[model samples]
Target: MADEVKLLGVVGSPFVCRIQIALKLKGIEYKFVQEDLANKSDLLLKYNPVHKKVPVFVHNEKPISESLVIIEYIDEVWKNNSIFPSDPYHRALARFWAKFIDDKIVTPSFKSVFTVDEKEREKSIAESTEALQILENELKEKFFGGKEFGFVDISAVFIAFWIPLFQDIIGLKLFTAEKFPNLYKWSQEFLNHPTVKEIMPPRDPLFSFFKGIHDKLHSSSK
Candidate 1:
């Protein structure tokens, strides 16, 4: 019998989706335990003692934190379907892009939507566009990543999934069909995957719900 796996996540999180994608790819059976960020449960706090963040995967009895870490662990443990490249160099390259996004785009992308200040919005846009440009240049000749769906492709697909929802929040049109054709095509390909398409939140619900949350978080902070 397979080990019992439990995931602590909030559907609102793209971070949670990363692990969910990997687990589905590996055909793992697991129970999802939803966590409320505003009032975190004891399980989430216990599993993720340091960060106390969602998307924590408990495999058997061992707790794994961080989405990327959880995904990599899934890829390793369930080796039948691999997310990283076979070659060591290629695997390193994939990790490089993942790290780049974590460092460059993720935080600013979140801030871009929640921040009301013009300066903050401008900064987020500038940083995000620069990061996107790097991806464009690197992945130009690629379904998404260097002839096959690899780790970089997996990490990048989130940009497409969330960008439109984010545009609604920011009241802008930075990511569009015409603006980034390559990225647009990649987005369609990534989202069209049966597993991804099936599990992802619908645009109407995700955007409307997150918009309200964004407004609430910002308002309460003021």
Candidate 2:
């Protein structure tokens, strides 16, 4: 039998979208099963019992959780459309920066956007800004690690897409062209890439979806 692949994911999720981008880049055919994170399905729980999260990738009968791990697996399994650098050191650097993006930018920015506490929100914003400045200085090329859109690019899906949406929802002016010109340019390139653009959720629906969450958070805090 041929290879069987399935992605259990929620719509409008940057994490899920990144995996989709990776799959599309590799020209892999797979089924996307929409998951309602509010009431997660048995498969999600079964496949990813530890995290109990969406974006659980199943190949044949094996399951893998975490977006970065799944992407790496996809890269290893499919040689075409390589996602990481060929050189050992460069590959190590790619992993390092990807981890930095997650730990520094993605986490802090997300906390800044979603938290109701003013002090906590400000702290997160500051942390995110500091990390973003470091990224801006490092990002001198078309993509991370030079030309090709590879591992680090996929890892930064949150910064490219979701952070802007979050900024809009919360009326925060965190990431902008003036503050980080290199990142602005990079986001444009990453967002417009054919493989990435094809799988990205439309802005209007995504905005509305996130707006509802923001409104709910504020109302609860009140």
Candidate 3:
């Protein structure tokens, strides 16, 4: 019997999106339960008591928290469309970059773009830009995993999708084709992937929502 799989996630969360993309890539069918972060559901709380976060993956009734951990679980369980590399060293490298993205890139980038304080924003932008440049150098091939969208690719989906939107909302240009040609090209390809294209929400509404958040943050900071 196939283990029943279900995902609790928020609509626009990049962490949640990571799991969604991984599931899609592996062709795994699962129920998606959207969570309201402001009023988190009882199920979400029950499944993820520690974080109380979205993106709690329940497989065979066992809960797994953390986006990257869930992605690794999905890859292990559904081996048909494997995302992680088969070799030990290659897998380690993939894991290293994925961790770097979460710790060094995505976290600081979001903080920089969303924070109301100018000094913090500048600091985060410098940190995130440096991380992005490192990633740009790492991408010697078409994708992070080289010629295929794999673990590192899935881990860095936020850079491919949300960064551009955040840049527009904040009126900043952090990523450019000329400055980071490889990453810029990777973003284009990642966004255009059939599965990715299918799951992405319309740009206008997303931008409007982010703009409202941006305004709220700035107003509150005043």
| Candidate 3 residue pairs in clash (backbone atoms < 3 Å) | none
Task: Estimate, for each residue in 1-222, the C-alpha lDDT of model 3 and write its tens digit.
Answer: 977999998778899999989988888889999889989889998999999998899998999999999999898888887899999999999999999999998999889868988999999999999999999999988899878899999999989888888988888898989889999999999889998887776778878988898889898889
Greater-TM-score candidate between 1 and 3: 3
Write one digit per residue (lDDT tens) for candidate 2, span 2-97.
999999998888789889999999999999999998898998989999999989999998999999999989999999989989999989999999
- Count of steric clashes across candidates, in order: 0, 0, 0
Please give, for residues 1-222, the per-residue lDDT of candidate 1 as tens digits. 679999999885788888777777778899999888999999888889999998899999899998888888888888987788788987788888998887777778877887767698789988987887777667665554565566777677568788778887867888777877787777787888886776676678888887997889778877
Candidate that would win on lDDT: 2
lDDT of 2 at 92: 92
Candidates 1 and 2 compared by lDDT, better number:
2
List TM-score per model, in order.
0.92, 0.97, 0.97
List per-candidate RMSD values in Å.
Answer: 1.9, 1.0, 1.0
How many residue-pair clashes does candidate 3 contain? 0
lDDT of 2 at 122: 92
Q: lDDT for every model?
A: 0.80, 0.91, 0.90
Model with the higher lDDT, candidate 1 or 3? 3
